[model samples]
Target chain A: MPLAATLSSVPVVIDEEKCIAHKGCTVCVDVCPLDVLAIDMLKGKAFMKYDECWYCMPCETDCPTDAVRVSIPYLLR
Target chain B: MKTVEWSVDILVVGGGTAGPMAAVKAKERNPQLKVMLLEKANVKRSGAISMGMDGLNNAVVPGFATPEQYVKEITTANDGVVNQATVYAYAQHSYRTIQELDRWGVKFEKDETGDYAMRKVHHIGTYVLPMPEGHHMKKVLYRQLKQKRVEVTNRVIATRVLLDENGAAAGVMGFDCRSGDFIVIRAKAVILCCGAAGRLGLPTSGYLFGTYENPTNAGDGYAMAYHAGAELENLECYQINPLIKDYNGPSCAYVTGPFGGYTANNKGERFIECDYWSGQMMMEFYNELQSGNGPVFLKMNHLAEETIATIENILHTNERPSRGRFHEGRGTDYREKMVEMHISEIGFCSGHSASGVWVNEKGETSVKGLYAAGDMAAVPHNYMLGAFTYGWFCGENAADYIAETYPAGAKPVIDQTQIDLERARVEAPLLRTDGLPPAQVEYKLRRLVNDYLQPPKVTRKMEIGLERIQQVRADMEHMVAGNPHELMRAMEVYHIADCAEMAARASLFRKESRWGLYHYRVDYPQRNDAEWFVHCHVRKGADGEMEHLKRAVEPYIVELDDTEKSAYDRLRVKREPAIA
Candidate 1:
């Protein structure tokens, strides 16, 4: 059952300049229903770790620093 | 490895439409009780109405329709295998629930005279109530929750309902996605309002997340209820909606149908008399698409500009708002083009059709301290309005049960052995850094569901589906989760696999075709009301095998004459002869 890392353009993106995750804000990651976004321990920024995105907008709407933007997945668009 | 525990009078799992109302009503019922509303996501927006609903699909406004009428309609729409008692309870309280939401700052479409503006979408009665500004519904509910002082826990995914020695619900178990801490909450009464088993089927688009449901509802509630020894009814009557082709969201016939938009075939002719979403209507939709007509569309081009604009405004702003962008990308405009429609991959939803955790009129599941409502609860056509009403029922009822079953120096017992095993199961994926990816396992599982259990179900295919699902169950042991985010998905794969197995089992248990396309077994091609009219229920047995039972359809309180009984079967309007 060996698995390989699959890479693709994630639908949710965070603007690091606006992202305040370094300041202990995990709003986007916390509010996302699918839990696709996670805090990057190295950079202390939130990033989409899973490609499965419902595009339900809770992540974008609840982001306090206005750091998140949701794009329709490239495959569907 | 860290463990957190909570003890409360009532624990409401899920913060979606029903869970919010349940929390609010429970608090309002008995202010002394400790009510905790647990959510996998934030309560501000979650579950089926994360973006809020476009309209109340089943509103029984007093002047527009009576409780009896709404009950009868649901009885027929579900193809007759409904517990009228459960639907009747919702009907009796439908308008009151609407008024309560209205007082809480939720809006519904109103006529010029200030009365509720109701529209007819069903075959016989008027029920649909549009809320063009319904996007703020969750905000309204969240405010109520805050005002009522319901403890809200966000980001905790509940995996199981802990059973007492007597088999009643005692507590629940799961972990927090943020810190990977094990969570075990104990309660006197537990209400499960987790929405549909929506992620059971892979969308035809081949994209994992483009599901008709919010996708967060991976049927965790259904699996938990079954494991708790609660009966789940009518699993074979799968929810196969007519949705936007590539986007996999609803084409929203309910929103546009009242505005003169109808489901049309390739020639752009109306096929069904009613725009309501019943299995029979969906059967016609499936047929037309497969016929020479090939593809179907939501026809609105014939409508006036004003009507189309109103429809677009409501459709683009509420429910699945990304739909507008999907339409834009496809170059689809309601003013000139018909929106393409397709049969969605199947799943179980009591909200849309009759397949969910079985509950009586009081919203109580067979498990004594356990109650269920909303899409997960087995009440036919229990849409957003029904969810709210049933939530109210469950809240007050669970509150009463809590007071009655109050423990004096008694505590909810936990099986430490079970807890250790669950912790091991949740942590295994994280332990193995390079095993089968959660997404791949989920994709393969749902694809297998689509391949083996999609409607027009054949016995051999379903049996094969059961075998493949067992393999998925075994493959789950080798699943990999790089972080808590992926762990959430890995756990969701378990729920989806359980749904796949139970779906196949339920489809096979019923020996005759019913609900049109929902249970149209190829081998058993005709509807056999005599032998298969009873509701098929499944639960985990004492032997740890899936057990099936037959529950008789409660005698209808609202008697339908023979013509009314078959009203849904006549959805196709008669076409007149053409003159030479």
Candidate 2:
């Protein structure tokens, strides 16, 4: 199994109240260097694309609000 | 611990005009010698050429004037504060530097008479000729460096200079931006042509903004040299630009030509018209803004509806005579301009701080084996024109000295402990639990420095500002960084704190105001030239406390004719009225 698949099974939780619209958290947009999490301005938060997530944690680390939470699978836990 | 070691005869810290020329001179002196250049940013994007300004102030080609007349003009413009020896050296070598640039394949804009055009642009002193294709100058220098087989390491930030037991420069350690790898380069001689530290809390000058493109210039080389025990001169002297269109934006001044703009208070009254001196004009504007007439905008009178039409017509017709297209392209549409065309900030002709590291005639710092050139070194009384000229002289002299004193093929040991400490320091922000995000920290830092820590404000609330900055520095200590990019941001904050502290210390030490632009104390409004004409020097003590020392101004030897001195004095008296 690919690392993406193994990591995809984990839950991705985002706190919506903290997003500042800085656009620094767009980890999954087209032309993005990393495609871990796609940002939807309409949704006012980031949507996890589990299959393409590089597990780079750029979105989590760069989030100004500390709103991003990434949980790995049971073996890592 | 693993280490990577490299060796070179001469290591140039900056790849700007001075750096490349210095390396080339070293190679010319010895063909078999090895030269290495390290740049914090890309070489093409360094110095005055990066912003496409061809040449700074120089009296190269005679234009209805002689070199002696040009020297008097410079001294008069500088208000008799220029170092005569440095100015004379520049006057003599100005033609040679220009000729070298021509040989390097750089082109200059010519007049209709088929001769190179010269403008009376005031940079160093009175006249500075513009280079139309100065960007090509950077490219030509880079190509020459390649031809000389000089090794260049781009995107490498030189953290510190390594000194041997005798306090001589042995090598340098830097971190690579792309790979996030640390590099240790051993060199017998090091030339610091790294330019001025831009991170100090001051308004952006055209030269500074034109170089960095962004606000990331945190005075890295200044801090590095100061830490290595170099005597820093004139830390309080900062240049203020009268024509910053937007205070919060990335854009800088646009060329408004000879017809200058007017600065107004919030009440829409022209304030600068009351004062003729450029420094005084800026000081009055700053005072107005502080006294609740703020968010002030510079208005240009020439940018009227007629000007917009002229510009639009020029752009539409692609006319050569109309410089309007240049203005409009920079978003300077007269019709839809936010302010009336009557009010515009004067662009292009502005002053930079005429102070830096104190160096003698040979550009040698107090520390042996470590030399400073360009804006980073202080040659008393010299401005940008002298800076460029002294840059060449120092670069050539340092290169030759290195070639003679230190031979090629010498390798030095790497300090692994120092490398680990630097890495840990950079990574500390990442490990923090965090009181604030990096962006928030950056915002707070900029606001505190710009609003409260600047010159006009420093007079009123300096003690409070210093205390606030101390607290802010403590807050920055808690800033977290998780990635390499974030680590760089954290390091920027550290560097800014270092520069801000030095500036504040320098500000506190100078009891009386000497230079109108620098050391502006609201409490002490008078220029106490009798008591405070001495140069201010700041150095960090063993306990990390800043030590302040006052030294007498170095005397200048000027062999000026009676007519020249009389004309110079007359111009000095008239300077106040001309700017007013």
Candidate 3:
């Protein structure tokens, strides 16, 4: 299949300054139900890689630094 | 990818509510046993109550409610088609389960005098017990699992239950959702707690992941058990909940009804006498929505400011916590505007409705060496507490089954051919680099379900739905995954299709309109008790065909009087004098 780009806004927003992925923390990525969060290796921070999210927030609540925030998806809002 | 194979004394599939309980109790029953709890997501946060529950929907506390009364209420709510033995068993043990969780640090609402703050939510009985700080529910269960030393394996999507030549459950086969490695495990006994088929119907929002159920539970247990030759009961008694419109979460009359909130219509007047969830109640809700006074709402504006604040605190903090954000985005203020309500898409769940793989009071299914409990198991109206109590029973009963017939000499036999077949089936999407996306296929499948299988069900529409489903079944071969994540969705599509066919077949077989909005067939629009009072069980026949057969509903141990039997049917409250 050819590569294609789609317009979407991810629900999970991570603060790179507070995200400890650079120090080897994957808590947000591990707890996500949809597995949509991935580490952006270049920035050494976690980011939402996919648009699919249930918004049932373990990622936000369980984060050590309170770096993660989940908003209702734009389509749903 | 290489296949990982292992053997255990017992294997518990699903680490959600009941699976962890089953695994813990199995080890507690006998210390010298190898038990495994397999989960598709992290066990710490998975299943229906992943974030946590707001309250216990049905708690039969001793002073507040009794076993007989609880049984009687469920029988009436289910329209008298209940197996009283199964329900009565849950009722009898319900308090013990509550106490056990309480001791393990799960919070429940209590009065100043230290008694349980039991409240009235159901039509006739007071069963709803508030758990305002119940957010740590999963963490408490995780503690018990670790204390019992039960083995936990996360991210393995169980695809099939392997059976021996004699047709008894021998083991299970699947693949890791993250690694794409095939997994096979042999066990003396297998317990499935894979929750409701929440993804069977497409949401109105058109979002694939926005489902009433934890979208991860795509009816995997129902499909795997059916393929293992287990009989599933009452597939037509679908779970159709009344949820917040578009947001698809509960307005939760269960929590706020005790605090003075009620379900109202466009005129801001009360309709139903009770806020309890039943097929009859859902039917009334549907009728009100369609009757020119269409589009219902949850009325809370009349309550005192303090009461409204308390209601918002719990509703926004637990269960589907993101509900608060959704309300904010819609600019819904309980102090001013009534929150809109709508009927949810259909699915199968014994926890809410009576549709699941059949199990007896002892938690044994038709097939030997197989046990099931929780939402997937067919015990009428067995909510969260019921799941815990039944999980306890299954764990203990399975321990006995394994102790009697196991590694001594009666070892479970493994069929290599079945494992190889499942490996190829799971890997098919990954192997095909170019094909239809799993998400698109699932979206199409669920949309067809909504078109034909949603309530006020029409015979012609259901028949057409089956035809579309069959065409989709053929297209399963063309599903290709972009990566391991997509592969998980690909596997889920197969399970969703299995549930859709079961729903269609069972709906067509009943031939009578029952369960109100759940199986409201337009062709046969009346309850035919003389012909359809029996439970319809569906399973795979010898020739690879879907077979439907009727079984007699067990004689009620606590019989209902005429008034009690018709309680649910009369949900619509009458206005004094005349409304015309």
Candidate 4:
């Protein structure tokens, strides 16, 4: 399997309760290097494509609430 | 994940009063060293000296009192529960911090006698002291930073400290506010100077009080340190300012100076005369209001006259004031401004808690490479009044330690995954679909804590408050932020929930109450010095649960003079007469 395809199998969960509406954070929008994830302000959350997410946990660690949870494929028992 | 790298000798987070001084002092100690500062808010706006307050505490003036006297005063106020060694260190080095600010061109107010004017405010007993001129202090510090060529990254929030293989602080991980990019700063030493969390559902007026100024001080440093295995002290001891200005408008505290005013409830009864310690009286008033005697208004003798005069003055002069037409010469302009500024209003005053991450005499936490300063780090017996002093000591010590341990040219390793993780975490809020509005969550959280978890209300309905907060937390799980701004607001409310839970948990753990105003327990009416005289430590466990640890109180050895001793005794006796 390709590296991008392997990475895309990881699960990304967002905790909506922790999101504060400050238009400053666009990590998901910018860090997707692949531009797979975009911020939807109307929903006040991030939208990701199942095939597009690279399984990078940048969103999980940078979140102030530790709200984003990432589970790597195969690593999740 | 892509990696980005930068190196510095010293990294100071939250460049308020102490961060700048720490950076300046580090450069002063060794000019060849590189010092960097990162602040979440605009560096010009937060921290101890941020508001242009015209005075610092009395650690500067010569011959008025010694550092020993200052330590004695603090320990007395804290009821001997303070860490005496840390208190001494802060008091002793306070003069040096003030002098350093002055050397850096920070100006202070002068007296008619040509010496630095001193005030007897906020000190134990009758000790008078010199303070920096408030507004000019900021200008001086900023100019010094510019002159020193210190690298400052403003509007950047530090999310976590970088831990090396040895579990020592290697540097910090943060997100840039503007670009939404992750910036990993590698430094030999990291100083956590993030100010205390203030935005937690504390009842604050709608006006332009300082509490509303910096919403970013959500105890980030404290939470980060706790998660990293640092001990936090006295998390239950929250400071309540007695007088908040107008609920409808902006105002500062009027109780700081000698204001000739009386506090009355809705029944027009003078409640404050019963106890000089206004914190107690205010809490009692809240209880009365909860018991159905409230919607109380503080009738300021000066304010009433000032309002009438301002109305007449505006009417006579044809100069339309922004607020409204004012009367001429009917009242004191100072009084009118006081009301306009929201200085005399009474509400639940919450900003920086005097409690936080526990540190030793050297400002070292349990973690080796980690150090805390400002409102974020917890030092016993030090109140917000002494924040600059404590910040100075902690910052200076951290800088010196970093300089001695690691010289220039020390390469720090950058983790690309860590950067990626951090960025994703910060932006998660912006990805939610459907849930509660950020503002509504904020309102509900604040209302819950204010109504139930506040000291006065805490005693009556703590269990109910806890249940409500838990339910609220569950409900919060359904909250969604549609945009980056909304996500930031969501993060703020989430932070508040974390803080409120910690505070309520701490309050519930300590069954017996001590420290008259700080932890007031109506049920456990007396100060059980024998059983309850220990500092409470809160930390997150391996299971991600908050574990509580009780450490013995450090003995205060400072001897007071006969007169001072008498005064101290009198103040303690006067604190809680109703319960006694």
Q: Please report the candidate that would top lDDT against the real structure.
A: 3
Residues B549-572, candidate 1, lDDT per residue (tens digit)? 998878889999888889999887
Which ten-residue region of model 1 chain B has the weakest summed lDDT? B406-415
Off by over 4 Å in 2: A1-77, B1-3, B63-82, B112-114, B123-126, B202-214, B247-255, B258-281, B284-332, B335-351, B379-388, B407-420, B430-436, B457-460, B559-580
Please state the interface RMSD for every predicted structure, separated by commas: 1.7, 19.8, 1.4, 21.9
Candidates in descending DockQ order: 3, 1, 2, 4
Interface RMSD of 2: 19.8
Put down candidate 2 lDDT per residue, B184-279, tens digits, no spaces. 787777887776565444333212122121233456667777777777877776544443332212111222232243445555555443222334
What Cα-based lDDT does every candidate model obtain? 0.88, 0.55, 0.91, 0.57
Q: What share of the true interface contacts does each candidate keep?
A: 0.66, 0.00, 0.59, 0.00
Sort by lDDT, top down from the best: 3, 1, 4, 2
RMSD of 2: 10.9
lDDT per residue, candidate 3, B481-577, as tens digits?
Answer: 8778889999999999999999999999999999889889999999999999999999999999999999999888998999989988889989789
Cα deviation in Å at residue B130, candidate 2?
Answer: 2.3
DockQ score of each predicted structure, in the order shown: 0.62, 0.03, 0.69, 0.02
State the lDDT of candidate 2 residue by residue for A2-77, as single tens digits: 1111333433567778765455654323211112345666775676643322222334544667877644322212
Candidate 2 lDDT score at position A34: 19
- Tens-digit lDDT track of model 1 for A1-77: 55555579988989999998989998887767777888998898999987878888778877998889887888777
Q: List the residue pairs that clash in candidate 3.
A: none
lDDT of 4 by residue, B393-448 (tens): 55566667766666665554555676567666666655556667766667777777
Best of the candidates, DockQ: 3
